[model samples]
Target: MPGLRIGALELSTPIFIAPMVGITDRPFRAFAREMGVGLTCTEMTAAAALVRAPEGVAARLLDLGPEEVPVAAQLVGNDPQVMADAAQICVELGADLVDVNLGCPVPKVVRLGSGAALAREISRTAAVLEAMVRAVDVPVTAKMRTGWDYQSINAPELSRALEDVGVAAVTVHGRTRCQKYTGWADWDEIARVKEAVRQIPVLGSGDVRDTALIEARIRAGAVDGVVVARGMLGDWNFLEQTVSQLRWGEPGPTPDFADRLRLAKRHWDAMVVHHGEQHGVRLSRKFVVWAIKGCDGAARLRARVADLFTQADLDELYQDILHAGEGPTGWHRPNFTSGEG
Candidate 1:
């Protein structure tokens, strides 16, 4: 695993934490960066929103610690001028790179002709990327699905178009827009895109469930790097595990109950500090589920955590999980390939 260079920034490894809406908030990005992810991105911020209220959006989404540098700001929208302006705002607000979210499959975004919807029209996509690249001094990149649908796979041609417009790199999520993460990501299609773009780096996204899958994808010569999305949920050490395997041929060890609990507590504290207790508790509900997923008595724990509204509530739940034995050994993990994250 060699370092990945996107224009001026150099990543220590090719393992990137994909910009996940609601999930990749500042606290999460900080945690992943501290755990040694190569690159971290902000959750997809709307281009029009940022242009209209740069200060407010920056305060809300662009906030980052000094240690979270080399982070990319991901923006999604259909208007070229608005996208360009948003990219410049992100650059001004300390983004090391600016990434366009052209692969998101959410119906709301697609309905607005953003995200995967952009893939339906090559000319519009090219124009948007060109505008963004020209607007920002920092590296400008795009993340896209293979195409709008299986019937119209155009990643190879799209890759060429993006490269021609001076994109620093592109990430290809192997499924079509129609697939919306239902099936396995096609590494072969990713390889085709890699081959099509001779100059810039091509990254693979989707189905990055474990270190084995990450290694297999890279070893197959399909992508220079990978964007770990849902696979990273509840596992801060996931990137470190992949990097360890790449460097030492061992993924170290699976986090035991105590380690998981400690990390979960840290995440909880950060959320509370970043957003007050009321909202933080609400935001942490899903995180609590992810933290305790596959653990012994997880169902009961989730039920209890759902009604939690304060730090005391969280403490009691943590105590309960600790009292239980380490979760079922060798627990099963779903192959979450959905790019909805």
Candidate 2:
């Protein structure tokens, strides 16, 4: 497979890990990169927050390790100039690309006239993206839904406008804001966006759980690439498997229970080092839950995760789980319904 070139930055594979809020943090991104993900992104950072508090929590959202380079910094906002300034800040902080968030369907974000709300007005969204393009030297991209609702499907038109305004690539999550994560993604709509754009790459997202799905999309010429979102929750090695399958027609090795436990331990340690013990332990619980999904005694393990307050507590649990010698012999498939983007 040829590398995906967005502007001057080239990715070894076309498979991208979505910029999921709260899940794609610095530690998690670094881990995904090590797992052979073609490209990674920071969690969606609010442009206003970045502008309002560069030294605050919003700035911390831009945190990236050297190992996670060539990552896109995703920004969410409606103000063109503020979004522009935020894009500049992202570039200054070493983002290889800046992606505008136009697909997030969360009520809080939509209420602010950002996220999917931007897609409601193509011209305004284009103006915001144009300012961002002019503000940074890196490639500017946008991730948008099909439209506000089934009655207002407009990704094809919106994608064209974004392309005209210097957006390098567009990722279409094949659902309208109204559908949220329910129902099947409209790949037909995604294909329409691909047809609407004349030059830039068009990637597809939503419900992409396995390599075969990616192969089907790419082979059908509906999308230039696939963005793995919730599918990557517990299965950190998903991207690696995807790359192998796409390139070699082989799904590659699946990690067993012991392997997963070890990986989970490594992830826990990294989270601790990145966020400190107190916050890190709490932040890492969800990841632990994801990792243990489909494993024997998973429910019991999940119940214990809530009480984990210290490294020693996690360590004790890890040993017990390891000694229990339970879980799938093959790769664990994450239960996406239990989580959100």
Candidate 3:
């Protein structure tokens, strides 16, 4: 797993953290990078919303480090002009690449002909892709699905079309818009899309929660890389660990349970510093649940932590989680596949 190359930047691995609204903000993005994710994108922001200053959302999503090169800013909307304008803003703000969102299955987004809704209108989708790619000198990428539904599994054709317009890469989430994350993703379709295109990396974007699924996708033969979405929310280590496995051909030695917990705490502390205590503790709550996933009593801890708003309260709960167990057992994890949505 040598770092992935997107135009001028070479990522250390193919494991990029997919942007999730209200989820993949700056602390989360930086945490993933520290843990060795190859690339990280901000949560999807509306192009229309950017008509005003995007600074509020921008502050939450932006990060730049020498090692975290090729940072991508993902934008979502229906209007070709707004998408182009917003994409230009992202590029000017130091984005190494700009990713257009086409696979988000959220109801609010799809209803607006943004996200996966764009999957239904090939002409408009083509227009947005071509305009965005041409609007900025930076490489343009797109994240999309199999189609709007089973009847519309048009990714292969769409992939070809997007490539014709010069999209540097395409990520295919196996489920269709109608599926709404309810069924298994059509990975074979990802392979189809990859074959349909000639000059870009095609990434498999669904059901890749761990190394096993990753190897399976690579074996299927269409993907140049894999994207981790929900699997990364609670565990920042996913990317770093995945990279070691891909690079060394072996799972690296596991870190101690306490080590994992400290990493979580550092992330929490960083959040508190970055966003202040109230919001930090609130945001940190979800991560605590993810960090303590493998342990017994995690549910109870999550319930308790939800009400906590102060630093001391967090400290108390964190200590309780640490002491309740005889020792750290690392994170609890799930087989979260986009198809499972």
Candidate topping lDDT: 2
Model 1 C-alpha lDDT per residue in residues 168-258, reported as the tens digit of each score? 9999989888988787888889999999997798999877877876777677777888998878777767777987776666789988767
Cα-based TM-score, every candidate: 0.95, 0.95, 0.90
Two-way TM-score contest, 2 vs 3, winner: 2
Q: Would you list the clashing residue pairs of candidate 2?
A: none
Every candidate's lDDT = 0.83, 0.85, 0.76
lDDT of 3: 0.76
Model 3: per-residue lDDT, tens digit, 21-107? Answer: 666767777788777777888877777777466576644344433444558888888788888888888876778888988887877
Q: Would you list the rank order by lDDT, best first?
A: 2, 1, 3
Clashes of each: 0, 0, 7
Q: Root-mean-square deviation of each candidate, in angstroms?
A: 1.8, 1.9, 2.9
Worst ten in a row by lDDT for model 1:
330-339
Off by over 4 Å in 3: 54-68, 326-331, 334-341
lDDT pick, better of 1 and 3: 1
For candidate 2, the per-residue lDDT at 195 reads 94
Residue 26 of candidate 3: its Cα lDDT? 75
